[model samples]
Target: MRKITLSNGDTVEVECLSCALTSGLIESDGGVVIETDYLHAHQAVAYRIE
Candidate 1:
């Protein structure tokens, strides 16, 4: 896990990029496209893909 400081001066613990994106801890351009108990999917932008 990793800890990050937000612009609002709050701290959050994150597991990984996918977890963060799925949990709404971070924002994605297209947002979450699909979510399930065992799976999650979302549209990936150019920067994210890179």
Candidate 2:
């Protein structure tokens, strides 16, 4: 598992599944749900925000 902090202070925790695929969720204090295969693939979960 890994945490990726965006330039806007948004966090994305993900895990490497393949070459260019990752699995995780998006954590934004600004109340937004950003979805992308870049952080969620192969049905893997590795992120949380609360």
Candidate 3:
């Protein structure tokens, strides 16, 4: 991951979520639910604002 500073002086970690998922850097729950020659869809239970 990489960190970037925003204009408000907030530094946040950055990463390519899509790339991570596809490349297996991040594992998707239940694996990929859908896929095609040009697309892929998977279940990702991530951060939740509740």
Each prediction's Cα RMSD? 5.7, 9.7, 7.5
Candidate 2 — what's its lDDT? Answer: 0.40
lDDT of 1 by residue, 2-47 (tens): 7765444455677676667776868666677878998888775324
Best by lDDT: 1
Q: Write the per-residue lDDT of candidate 2 for residues 1-50, one digit (tens) a residue.
A: 76765545555555632322321234333432344645422332234334
Model 3 CA deviation exceeding 4 Å by range: 2-14, 47-50
Q: Which 10 consecutive positions of candidate 1 have the poorest summed lDDT?
A: 41-50
Q: What digit string (tens of lDDT, one per residue) describes model 3 on residues 1-50?
A: 86644333444454966676677665554579988889989764353222
**Cα misplacement distance, residue 50 of candidate 2 (Å):** 30
Off by over 4 Å in 2: 17-50
Candidate 3 root-mean-square deviation in Å: 7.5
Clashing pairs in 1: none
Candidate 1 residues lying further than 4 Å off, grouped into runs, are: 1-15, 45-50
Error of 1 at 31 (Å): 1.0
